[model samples]
Target chain A: MEAAPPESAAPITPVLVAEHLERKLPGDPPVTLVTDIDLAIEPGKFTAIVGPSGCGKSSLLYLLGLIDRPTDGRLLLEGRDMMPLSGDERAQIRLRHFGFVFQFHFLLPEFTALDNVMMPIRRLGRLSLPGARERASDLLTSMGLGDKLHKPPDHLSGGERQRVAIARAMANNPLLVLGDEPTGNLDSTNSARVVELFRELAHEQGRAVVCVTHDPGIAEVADIRVSMLDGRICEVLRQT
Target chain B: MFPRLGLLLHIAAMHLLVRRRQTLVATSGVAVGVGFFLAVSALMVGSQTDFVKTLIAAAPHIIISDELRSPSPQPGVREYGKTGAVELHGYKVRNEVRGIKDWQQILREIDAMPGAIGSPSLSGAVTLRQGGRDEPLGVVGIDPTIETRVSTISEKLRAGRLIDLERVQGGVIIGEDLAERLGLGMGDIVAATSARGVSRSLRIVGLFKKGQSGLGSGTGYMLLREAQSLLGRPFVINRLGVKLPDPYTADAVAKQLEARHGYKAESWQERSADFLGLLLTRNVIMYTVVSAILLVASFGIYTAVSNSVTDKRRDIAIMRSMGFSQGDLQFVFVVEGMALAVAGVIAGWLFGFALMTVLGSLEFPIQGEVRHLPLDRSTRQYLIAAAASLFAGIFAAWLPARKTALVDPVDILRGAV
Candidate 1:
C-alpha cells in the first residue's frame, strides 16, 4: 500500500524527458513538424499541450509516447537513453509502460468492453485468463461500466465508449497515460468526466498524464499547461 | 502452444463473426470445392481400381508360353549382317517338339514356391461341324482341378460343370454364344477337326459366357486327354499359367521365371499396358479439374480477407497501438482462413459421402445380373482432400494477411488529435 502524497507535493524524479526533440518528413522539400522541444513529465501531474491545429502539439505528444521516432534529439525514459532502441523495442516499451487514448473510442468493434480492456493485459502476458478477466471486469465496474461489460462499442453511448477506452488505457497499470483529444466526440458532461478521470489517474494513482487537445476544458484543468505556436512551445505554466 | 494464442484466436473469431456474410460465402466456396474434388476423385479412381482388379482376376498374373522372347538370329544375319550379297530367301527350320516337353515338372516347381499356383493348358485352332454347318474356332484343353486355381473360367460357366469334361467321356465345353450359333445343346455330339487334319466326335459338356466378344463367340474347352488325342499332340502342354498372391509383383516374378525357363512370360500388367495408359490420361484430366476448383475457392477466401482488412482499418490501428505485433496480426488473419477451411472440410466430407452412397446404390445393366458402381471410399481420400483444402486456403489468405501487417496506424490515427 502507498500513502497519499502530502499537500506539499515535493518534486520527484521525472518519468520522461525530451531534450530538443525534432521530427522531419523526408521529401523534395522536407517538412519539419516539431522543433526545439525541451520537456520533462513528472509523475502525479496532468499535462496538456494546447495549440492551433498545425502547431505540432500532437507530434510532440507522439514523440513523448514512443509511438514516433525523433529525427534529431535524445529521449530518455527515467533517464535511460531511448534513442538507440528499435521500433519493435519502442513498441514493447509503449505496451509495458505507456497507454494511449485517442479521440475516437477506437475499440475493436467486434469485441465487448471487457475484452477491449483485457487486450493490453493479455498482450503483456503477465496475467492468466481468469485474472485478466477479473481485472478488466473490476476496472469497468469502477468506471460505472459493470452493466455494459459485455456490450460492444456500437451498443454503448458516446460517453460509455469513451469510458471504456479510458479503462483500456489504464488496464496495464502503465506509468504514463497519453491521450489525443480523448473526449473530442463526447458531450460537455462526458468531456468533464473524462478530464476528471485523467486528473485522478495522475494525482491519485501517481502516473504521468499527457494530452494533446484543442479542447479548452482540458487546458483549463491541466496541472501543467503547455502552449505551442508554429512547432515550438511558447509557454509552460504550473498551477500552485 | 503458440504464445498469446487464445487472445489471437478470440480476436480472429470476433472479426469473422462480425463479417458473417462474407465468411459464409468464403466457407461455402471451399466446401463446394472440397465436395466436388472428393466425389469426383473417388468415382474416377474407383472405376480405375475396379477395371484393374477385373483385369487381374480374369487370367493368371503371369503366363509362361512355349515361345521365345527374342527369336534366335538367322544364320545369314548373324554371320554377314544381311548384306553379304547372298540373299537367303528360302527358309528351312530345325524340327523340334510343338509344346513344352516338361510342363508337369515346371508346374510342380512353380507350385512349390510360396503363394503361387501354376496350371497347364494346350490351345489350338480347330474346325467344328454340326449338322452340315462348319465353323472354324479356337479351343483350349485344361485340367479341371488345376484350372480352377489359376483362372476365372470356372466362374464363367453358366450351364454345365467344369468337371463334366472328365465325367462325360469325349466331352467338350464351349461358349454359349458359340454353342447357340452352332445350334447345339448339352449331350449333342459334334465333329472337331484339328489343324493336323485329324477328326473326332466330342459331346457338349459345358456352356459358358465370356465378356470378350471374340472368346464368347469362337472358343471351346475340353479335357486335356481328349485334346491330345484329337490334335495328335500327346502328353504336351503349350502354356503354363502362374498365379501369385500379390498381382503387383507379377512383373518381377515374370522376369525371373522367363529368365529361368527360356520362355516368354507375359505379366498381366504388361498385357494391359494400353488400358493403363488410358487410365493415366484420365487421372491427369481429373486432377486438373480438381486443381481448378480449389483455385477458384481460394480466390473467394482471398477476396473475403482483403475486404475485411479494408473494412477494419481502424481496429487494426488500435490493436497495433495496444501492442499486437504485425506478425501476430498476420497469424490471426491466416488462421481465420484455416478455420474456414476446416469447416469446409467437415461439410465437404458429409456431402461427398452422400454423393458416393447415391452413386454406389445405382445399378447398371450388364449381361443378365445387376452391378453397382465401384467406389474407392478409402480414408486417405478424405485426408488428402482436407490437406489440399487447408493448404490452398492458407496460401490464399497469406497475401491479404501480409497487407494487414503493413497497415500504418499513424496514417489511420493521424486525425484523432
Candidate 2:
C-alpha cells in the first residue's frame, strides 16, 4: 500500500476534537499528566503521536479514544458534545464507531481467535451465527491468520495476536482506529509488517488511524505527525 | 433480544460447566433440603388422611348411647351452680331420645336432620347357637340401606348382601371370624340368645372381613327391629349410629347436638383423637427439623456466590467498562442464585416423592400403630416454602453481588486480582 497526504484544502470536518484538555494524577500535590492539549483528527486522515516514555502520550491517546475522561475539558466527536451521553450510550458508540488496539493486544484469554475478532461486530447487531462466523473469518483471512479461528490468544505468536487485535478494532467498520503502541512488543520484522498493515487500512479503506508510538520509523510512515513532550504537544508536522 | 439472551445463557452455561463440582454441591445442598422437607410433610398428611379413612370405615360419625339412669344422687348444686337444687342429671345413652320410640321413626328423623345421613344401628351382645356349639357375639342390628353412611366396613362386604335391618325378620351380617367360629356362612341359619334369656333364630345373609376388630370376639350384624324384638324391648335401641352431613365438621355438629338435644353423641374425631393427635404432633416436629436443612442450603448458596464473585473480579471489571450498571450486575448474581434454588426445588420434589413411595412400599417401623403414613402437598405450605427458598438464595448472593458491582474498573485493569 502507498501513502500520500491529502491536499491541504480538503474540507472534511474533524471527527474528534480535544480543546485545552487537562488531566491530573491524584497525589498529595497532584501532578499534571496531561495539560491543555489542543488536538483535532479529521475523517480519512492518518496521524501518529510520538514522544519519549514519560511524555503522557498513552494518556493522551486514551483521552482521545474516549476510554478515559478529561479532567477539565470537553470531548467532541463529529462536533457533537460527548459529555452528556450516558455510560452505556458512550460504550455503544465506542463499540460501534471507534476501534482501539493496545500494546498487549488485551484479547480476552478464554475466547477463540475468531470470537475475539467478532466481539464488537457481534455486539453491534443480532447477526445469525453463520453470518457472524463468516464475517469474522473473512477479517482474519485478510489479516493473514485464516487458519487460527479456534486458537486462543496464548497459543498465537505475539504478532499474530496483535493482528487479531487489529482485525477486532476494524471489525465494526469504525470510522477511527486508535493504536496505543500497537507494535511496541514486536520485533523489527513484525513491526514493519504491522506498520504496512496500518498504511493499507488507512489509505485503501479510507479510515482515519491515530497511533501512539515512540518508534521514529513507524512515525515517519504517517501522513501527519504530532509530537508531545511532558504533557503538551510540541509540534505538528503535516506532509503531502 | 434473542442475541442478548443467547449470550447471557451461553455465558451462564459455560461458567457452570467449568465449575461443575461446585455447581453440583450447590444443587445438592438445595435438593437434599427440599427432598427431606417433602418426604416428611407427605408422610404426615398421609397419616392424617389414613386416620380419617380408618374412622369412616370402622364406625359412624355419631353414636347414640343408651339413656343411662342416674344412680342415687350424692348431689350438690351441680358444681357450676347452673341448677338451683340438688338435681339428678340424667345420663342418656343410645336408647333414650324424646320422640325416637321405634327403629323406623329414629331412621326417618335421622335421615331428615340437616346435614345428617345414614340409617340407625342397634348393638347388643348375644350367643349364637349352632347344633351343639355356642359362641358369644357382638350383635349389631343394622338398617342395611344406610349402613354405608354409618360404618366403613360397608365397603368390606365379602359375600352375600348387606342385611335389611328394616325387615320384620331381619337377617344377620356376621363377621368372618364369628361366622367361622360358628361354622356358619351366607344363607345359613343360626340361633341367637340374649343376655336376658331372649332367643331368636336368624339367617346369615352377609359375611364381612374387617382385617381386625369388631370380629375376633364373634360380632354379629342383624336388623335393628329383630334385635329389639328378641330382647322383648320393642321400640328400644341400645345404641344409635349417626352419620353427619359434612364429614369435616363432624365433631362440631356432634358437640352442637349433645349441647342442644341433651343426648349423648360421638364424632369420628372423638373416636380417633388419640391416633390423629399423634400424627399432628409428629408432623409439627418433623417439618420443623426438615426446615433447618433449607437454612443450611442457603448458607451453601451464599458461599458459592461469594466465591464466584471473587473469581470473576476481572470479568466484572470488564463488564463495568462496557457500561454495566450496578443493577445489571445484581441481576446476574440474583438470577444465578434463583436458578440454583429452582433447580434444587424441582429435584427435591421428585426425590421426595420417590422416597415417600419407597417408604410407603416398605414396612416402616411405626411400632404397633395400625395407621399408614401418607404424603400431602397443601398449596399454602408449598408456596411458603418456595418463597422462603427463593428469598434465601437472593439474599445470600446480595452482599457479594453488590461488592462486585462497586469495584472500579481502573484498579482492576491495573492488575488487581
**Model 2 chain B weakest lDDT span, ten residues long:** B68-77
- Report how far residue B188 has shifted in candidate 1, in Å: 1.4
Q: Model 2 - which docking category?
A: incorrect
Q: Give model 2's TM-score versus the native structure.
A: 0.73
TM-score of the B chain in each candidate versus the native B chain: 0.93, 0.76
- Cα lDDT, all candidates: 0.86, 0.73
Best by TM-score: 1
Candidate 1 residue lDDT tens string, B257-368: 8888888899999998998899999999999999898789888889988887778777787788777777778888898888888887888888888888888899998977
lDDT for predicted candidate 1 compared with the true structure: 0.86
User: In candidate 1, which residue pairs clash?
Assistant: none
Count of clashing pairs, candidate 2: 13
RMSD of 2: 6.9
lDDT of 2 by residue, B1-417 (tens): 455455445555555566677778887888787777777766666666765676676677777565423322222433535656544457343332332345455556667888677556566778888988988888776666667545656666677666443442557777877777778787788888888799878887877764665455467677767776766566666566777757777788777655654556777788778978987788778777867878898887787777777777776655544434445556667667777788777777777767867877665554344544565656554565577777777888786777775676555643442
